[model samples]
Target: MATATGKNAKKTNKQTDTAGTKSSQKDGGSYQAKDIEVLEGLEAVRRRPAMYIGTTDARGLHHLLWEIVDNSVDEFLAGETDRINCTLHKDGSSITVSDNGRGIPVDKHPKTKKSALELILTTLHAGGKFSDKNYARSGGLHGVGSSVVNALSTEMIATVRRDGHEWMQSYKRGQPTAGVKQVRRIRGHGTTIFFRPDDSIFRRTKFNPETIRQHLEDISFIHGGLKIFFHDETKGETHELHHPEGIGAYLEKITTDGQKKSVHEIPFSTEKDDRGNRIEVVLHWTEATDEEVRSYVNGIRTHAGGTHESGLRTGVAKAVKNYMDVHDIKAKGVTVTNDDIREGIVTIISVFLGDPMFQGQTKEKLNNPELSGQVEGLIRPGWKRGSTPTRRLPTRSSAGSCSPPALAWPA
Candidate 1:
């Protein structure tokens, strides 16, 4: 086709585009700043809960619960407290999470003039986790977890056991009903949040005991030192999940539950503190034909996977290769691949970082570019350390010639 070139082409296209825009605007009406809508208070979260909690279905309903629990867990991680108790009320729609940690401050906010507890429960992007002063590594980024829950909840009550006495405040749809009230004299410190998910927003407001129990179990596995108690008033039962054995025990439980036998008598696992971040991993070879990995960033599950998983896979492959080279083990006519090395391997990787970049408000994936390298660095060295006198990889030798040593369980 014949066409204009260079400067003439640019001029022609620009004129045509500008003229078309003017014509369209004249017909459709002009755009105006008035068209924009600024959602105030917690209305933005209420208007579109999915943007923050992923979905308005059953999962999102539980996300509201998770946000509060995670805040308490953050306290535990900060070495502020230990015990966390979660109660599902008989009404089925209400829940109460109590933690024996340094409670939310009840002092007047220097800027807002609102009580710290009230401000935290009523505002978005307002929390102590914004800096390392309160929490070294917290799952609460954007500082909206508690407030979002309050916004979505029909009623929320925040009880703080600080300032020498217990302070109680109530909120309705993210607005404080009244000023902080001083409850009867009480000792110690912590926070208790009671909330009911707004029925108008969620398809189902009833909290599933099984779903919550499973989640608590998984969290207990991750934070081995933290004690979690679940009181299911639905069944009048109380269950406690405390596994000081940590992820090592978690791996064993998962494999056992899956009916998969481990190739190693003892799985390879590591728990190391790098500065403020804690890196944890537990894994072993199995009889399965494929691999499965579960990764988490800052106590929040990363279901979509991310740089951490990439680092894990790379470090694992490198460790295998390094071990082969160090031992002078080789197969003359065979080739080893990363997939082969990882086959039938199931692993759980949990990392805690001071600042983690989440993919979205849902925090379903981790996006930090440096995290992968950090994870890999830890994994490689961890594998070497695990290869001590009592722990060794499988050795192989075939009659005709050595086949690529099928990575079996460690002996």
Candidate 2:
């Protein structure tokens, strides 16, 4: 009986030891440098293109166009280029964007010892947008737009006409297939990029002309005097987008839609704080109760309203409340609110600064706290000037009560 008990204990100890070894093997098999994976250069971008371009859907397809177009727009803002052309091939496989800006530097980079054009195309965060000397204000602030677009493209061709020569380079899936070679002697200065989206990375590869047209129109409206030409080889149609009046023209189109009646004959516009950081505002009110407020920071649209928008609202509200109080106007048992002042109003607020802080890569909103106070201070005077009446207020109304006078905005 004693020998049998000892044998049973030994069996239990063996089973426990075997179970512990299996558990250890499962938890800590091997930890070494080989276990870690490092993605170099544009490999990380190809592995996670969605993270850079937002998504792999139709919006991402459109974003590729915008990224390229924005580079041209930055050139326009820098006063280097006035004209840009975009063409969509009939086969729905390729698109080309050409701009009349100073062609990308063709000289070899000092650090990489590669052609500046090649360095700009192959490396991430390599561009003039990072330096204040090359660009005072730019839409492509991150400097990753072009390279990301190049990485996701299956085939890309870049052409530059500068230094009395036309240079050309080709790439396949972000790798240079050919060196920067001279195509021919040329007179003009500009850069052209032609690329085909990779089918494996995107769910759809076709280019949408209408969507591209709309985006170009918005960009043209935002930056007046920048001409954009869009040609669709598929439909043999061409469209030109140019707005000289800037956001004021955009507001005019919004007011003429026939759904709203304008309270002012012309929009009120003001430019202030012009020493370094500048704020520009254009605003008008309509009969409908819907509010349309568009804000931008350094040319990038802020769909998500930021502190700058908040400042505009606060300034307008304060100015309107002051006008109402001075005029002795009263709503029955109701306190005036910011919404009440903004009802049926259309406003465009644009800020130009040395450095802008955005929340994320997409730049949906502005995060600079100083802009809120600056915008408020800049726009309050404009609102006061627009709301102040030229004529004196009446002593009393027919019913022995005071009523508010009609509000008018300047042309």
Candidate 3:
């Protein structure tokens, strides 16, 4: 470890050696070759980036953005940060992200012994999120976000302000190009990452402003007053996505009532026994063109609705039909498909937990098979117990599932 011009630099060197033994944990006992397993080097990420971040195209590139954004969001959940800034550089080959959050700890990780910052960047499947004590809720709890991004980037610069000083590190293709070094002393705290995607891994390195805008807008809705600043230097534009009313504002923007009667917004919230789990649900129906049900597990989007959503659908359909039965509204041949029950429904389900089991490379689905039933069990009862409002839901034109609208990027 090298010290620089900072008041805190004279303190004890918090750096540790990058040496450790591979061990397996079984029945709370540690063992060793049967225990020791290795993933070789950066080759796994290069060969299977999609299995980690979802796609190899523009969406995958955007997933890199999410990985970095997730760290900032983790800070928000940890109650240490509130504002985040994302800038697309003029060259189009790089992105610079800065967040006013509790910066990544610059201390040494006990296991790997290197500066935690360096270990997180150079190694795979390592970070502070593994244990619930480290974070109350996290999006990249699997610890693949930063490492995967580093592996796929041609270059990366990470800077952190903590303990009254600024520490910096850089990486080239997942390996450190320079050792961890302190640069300057700074007030307050934050982390900034500037990276250029590897042309060898990513077919293109250009940034998409509209895509970033939409994502920041969506995240702003979820986070409610959290400020997110967007700067497209390539396009010479800057904007902020912040909503005081939160999801309500998001729904109002996307929903328009046509022939449907004004129905009460059915609000439901429940916490599970899964130690540090929260599920918040808001649902309302309109005469809108489609059903928009977005599910999130610990801030990560579950685009391919998993079992949790399936349970939600089943609970909604059952509750509605039960209410219809109680009212003696004689209607024949009416069966509630997930589609039928959710028609014109604008709903957002947010689940926050320390650890999320996600499906596949892109993590498009929540993979905690048990949690699906857990959410259903917790939420279904709420719906069943709530008083069902009386209103004739207008017949809606069925517009199946939504796909990404036309967005311009490299082919």
Query: lDDT: which is higher, 1 or 2?
Result: 1
Backbone clashes in model 2, listed as residue pairs? none
Predicted candidate 2 versus true structure: per-residue lDDT over 199-244, tens digit per residue: 8999999988888887788778888889999999999999999899
On a 0 to 100 scale, what is the lDDT of residue 274 in model 1?
73
Winner on TM-score between 1 and 2 is: 2
Per-model TM-score versus the true fold: 0.86, 0.89, 0.79
Find the number of clashing residue pairs for candidate 3.
Answer: 2
**Residues 1-411, candidate 1, lDDT per residue (tens digit)?**
989999999999999999999899998656677888999999999999899899999999999999999999999889988799999999999999999898998888889898888888888899998889988888997889999999999999999897579989998888899889998788888999999999999999999999999889988988889889999999999999999888788888888888887765767776678766678887988877668898878778899999889989998889777867777767565566677678778899999999999998788888888878877887777645534422223323242333343232222
RMSD of 1: 7.0
lDDT, candidate 3, residue 246? 65
Cα error of candidate 3 at position 253, Å: 2.1
Winner by TM-score between candidate 3 and candidate 2:
2
- Candidate lDDT scores, in order, read 0.84, 0.81, 0.73
Q: How accurate is candidate 1 locally (lDDT)?
A: 0.84
**Candidate No. with top TM-score:** 2
